[model samples]
Target: MDFIQQKDLSCFNTLGLKSWAKNYISLCNETDLKGVLGLLKSGAPYFILGGGSNVVLSEQIDQIVVHNQLKGINLVQESASEWLVEAAAGEIWHDFVVYCIQQGWYGLENLALIPGTVGAAPVQNIGAYGVELKDRLDSVLAYDPLTQTERVFNNGQCCFAYRDSLFKHEEGKGLIITAVRFRLPKQWTPVLSYPDLQQYESLQPGLTAQAILEAVCDIRRRKLPDPKVTGNAGSFFKNPVIPAQQYWPLKQQFPDLVAYEQPNDCYKLAAGWMIDQCGWKGRQLGNAGVHARQALVIINTGKACAADITAIAKAIANDVMNKFGVLLEPEPVFVGAGY
Candidate 1:
């Protein structure tokens, strides 16, 4: 483990926001974790960070940043029709998905190009192109900081909601994920359920895992801004889910409302459409602005502070709520001072 004081966290986060942490340590294994935890016990507040894709550091973090760098991959189990692959907490998510597809494994191809780590996947229940991580997750290994014990949680235990999981909830706080296991199909048909995905399929009749991955990548490339070039999280807010009865009345007021009804009698409304309708797309406020192509994403044009970005996001949410009567929830975890 390499420990440093007054560490610059600009390179660690995808947003490229300049922030400082009181102390930072990168843990490569379980043994390294023990030593790091010792520092935490010695009266240091700490935060566990993975790929740093889904977070926005609002201010200088006075706490210790424990960068989860544990890495490894192994086949835990296999059968004629399926296999279970286990990955450490720090493994890059998109790269792992591509690896599985290369091995002829199915299920994760639709989720290709998502930025983050294996441990963070379960926290957000990351999804794309009509497929969610919960569908492939076997279990997750996490260490409870309070209990000081390792626990394994199965699919049902995850309590997955749209773009959320137990880890994002109150009961699962202070648990640092160590690894995750996924059950993947040996033979399967690709899912082209989303409207864009279906249209892409029409262009190419038969598709495999690699083809689906390429399509997803292409779609994302055209829609979302690349974090490397533009400082932005994939989507700033989640698609709001509301009761079916509430959705229809809102739809009546706005006939162009985009929504999908879930099996549980709820409607998931398109956040991007709402933001775009409110005339926020491509709109700029100093260094902070909504991505020209994707209204759901808020970007930092070099000099924007975390507060500026948060202010812009809040304004978008307020405008959407005023127009559509639907409240928008931020997708990224806000650390330090919040909006």
Candidate 2:
């Protein structure tokens, strides 16, 4: 294993926060993971890093950092109704979505342009445009460092909820995801229920998966900054899901409050809308600022550190909470103390 020491990770994470890993190991093959996992099991602290899209490092990391680099995408099976596609943990998520379209596979079009790796997808139950990862996930293959064994968790076993999964739970803390397999349906259906995609209905006459993918990409491009150009980890806060009864009274007060009804009579309120109402949108605090286009995003304007970003996010959350009774929770995982 080519383990490096004292590696700077400022560029690795999407937020571009200044951070350093005390010891770093890049695992390009499955075999490379055994040694790293063994070390972690034997009382060595470690953090498994994927595409570094959904994390914010507020301080230098003292543990060993294992960067998952395993790469592969293969068609596992095909039938009249479904296509089983498996991708390595390190495969770029958008690239994989594009590949599926090229292969004539559908069902992932609505999830296009989501940042992060296949491994990270299940961890966060990534969702966008009225679709979530758990909607098409077949199973997740992960390695349990404590047990020194590989475990395959089917969709139900993953315990997927809104922006959450078993991987984020206590029992899954020591597990390292190796790969993800998605079951795409052969019967294609357009998911234009979202208002943005609904506007593209005129193109629905002969719209293909590529067309939907392109439309979604265009929407994301307009709404979000390219992480390469502006440092950010996509949506900074998860949409707060409040009970329908509670949301009704709040809705009566704030007629412009954006929310969507869920299966269990709960309403997923727009965190961005509330933040914008709190006057955080397009506003800056030091080097970090809320995105002008989307209040859900907190951007690193220039020379923004992890502290700058977290402090601004907290202020926004606090403001929203005070204005409304709902507490806004951050979406990105914090990798350091007091963030």
Candidate 3:
């Protein structure tokens, strides 16, 4: 296994924050994965990085960073009702979604254009267009360094709940995800539950799975800034899911509050709407700023440092919390010191 020492990772992460790792390794296959784990210095801090899309590198890291680059896609199972496709952990998520659509597998179309890798998808329980990764995930193959054993977790075992999974828990830590299997239903139908998608259906008429995929890609492109053009990790905050008791009174006070009803009478308030209402949209704090068009995103404007980005985010969160009395949780994992 080849390892680079004191490697700079400014460009590796979508946020484009400057940081360095004490040691780094990029694995291309299962063999490489197992081999490197055994070589890692015991008791030393280590981090498993996917596409680096959902992480914030706040300072220089002393840990060993393992970059997952394993790649493959196979049709593992088939039945009259569904098809099971397994993709390697390192496969680009958006590309995999497109591949599934081309192969007539339809469920992942709603998750198109989501940045990051297949492995990171289940960890974050990634969601968009009214569809979540948990909806189609069959199982995940992960290697736990604790026992030095490989394990499989079914969808239920994953314990998915709104951008969260077992992979984010203490027990699941040190487990390197190897591959993810998705169960795409053959008797598929377009998920048009989201208002924007519903609007597309009314205007376009007769939307196919591919059409939905395209529409989602287009919608995301218009809504999100391209990371290549502007450094960002997509939505900076999770939509706050508040209890109905509080939501009802808050709704009366802020009539234009954008919120959606969840199961069990909870309400998911739009984080972007609240930030925008706090007068943060298109505003900049030093080199970091809230995206002008989408208040949910924080952007690195040219010379922004990790501190600059975090300061902007803290200000936004503070303002929103002060105004609405709802604490806004950030989406990206903050790495390094003083985070």
Candidate 4:
């Protein structure tokens, strides 16, 4: 592995935060794990970066940064009821969704246009519109660098939750996802449970998977700013899930609360709505600003650093908490303590 010294990574992260790495390497091949393991064994600290759509980078990282650029996609099998599709870790998530749709496989349309790589999806159990990755996942192929061996974990093994999976835990943290296999249903139905999709389908009357995919893309494009044009990490915070006991009183207090009742008697409160209610929509602190249309997004207006992003995020979170008593948690991973 050829490690570049002092690599500039402003363009590497979706937030466009100015950052520098003491050592950096782009892993384009799975076989390069041998070299990566050697470097790790040499007592050097390291960080694994995927599509860079879900992270906040610090100004300086005094460690090795391994960028995942691995890529491939294959149809493993075609059953009477479903299709088994597999994609490499570094494959663009939106591209893979389009490929599955092109093959006539359905079930992932609701998650269309989500940024990041296939590998990073399972880490956060990426979801949008009305569906989640766990709903279509067959299994995940991961490499254990310490053991120098690979293992395949089924959907259940993933321990998927709202915007989370086993991959975020300690045991699965070091496991490098190589590829992801999805079981997309052939006899598909539209997931129109989300209010946006529900209204869309009501307007369209008869909807197909392709149409749903297009609608999802349109909805996302309108809500999320392109990382290239205006740097942003999509949704900045996760929707807070509160117990039913607590939700009722809050609901009574704020009748216009936007929330979805969970299957487990909890309520997933919309973080964006709460932030907007707190008078934070389109607000700015330093170089960071809340996206005017989508209060969930914190954007880099111009060369914003992680500090600028954090400052705005902290202010919004604090305001939301003070008003609603719900603590907001950031969805993106912070790469350094400085942020």
TM-score of each: 0.96, 0.97, 0.97, 0.96
Candidate achieving the largest lDDT: 3
| Per-residue accuracy of model 1 over 1-339 as CA lDDT, tens digit each | 789998988878888887888888988987887887666665457788898898988669987788998898888999999999999999999989888888777889889999999989999999998899999999999887655678999999999988989998888856889999999988787788888988884347666788889989999999898889998878989999899899889989999999988888998899999999999999998778999989988998887767887889889999998988899999999877776
In candidate 4, what are the lDDT values of residues 1-339, reduced to their tens digit?
A: 667999999989988899998889887885676677666765566778898898998899886898877899999998888889999999999998998888888888888889899999999999987788898999999877667678999999999998898988888977778899999887788788888877764338667888998988888888789988999999989999999999999999999999988888999999999999999989888999998899999999997888888888888989998999999999998887544
lDDT of each: 0.87, 0.89, 0.89, 0.87
1-339 per-residue lDDT for model 3 (tens digits): 568998889889998887888888888876787777687636567899999999988567877888899999999999999999999999999999999989888899989999999999999999999899999999999987666778999999999999899998888867889999999999887788888888874336666789898889889998999999999999999999999999999999999999999899899999999999999999999989989999999998887777887788889999998999999998888877444
Query: Which residue pairs collide, candidate 1?
Result: none
The residue pairs found clashing in candidate 3 are none
Q: For model 3, how big is the CA root-mean-square deviation?
A: 1.4
Clashing pairs in 2: none
Stretches of candidate 3 above 4 Å error? 201-205
Runs in model 1 lying further than 4 Å from the true structure: 201-205
RMSD of each: 1.5, 1.2, 1.4, 1.6
Flag clash pairs in model 4. Answer: none
Q: Cα lDDT for residue 150, model 2?
A: 92
Candidate 3, 173: how far from true, in Å? Answer: 2.6
Question: Is candidate 1 or 2 superior in lDDT?
Answer: 2
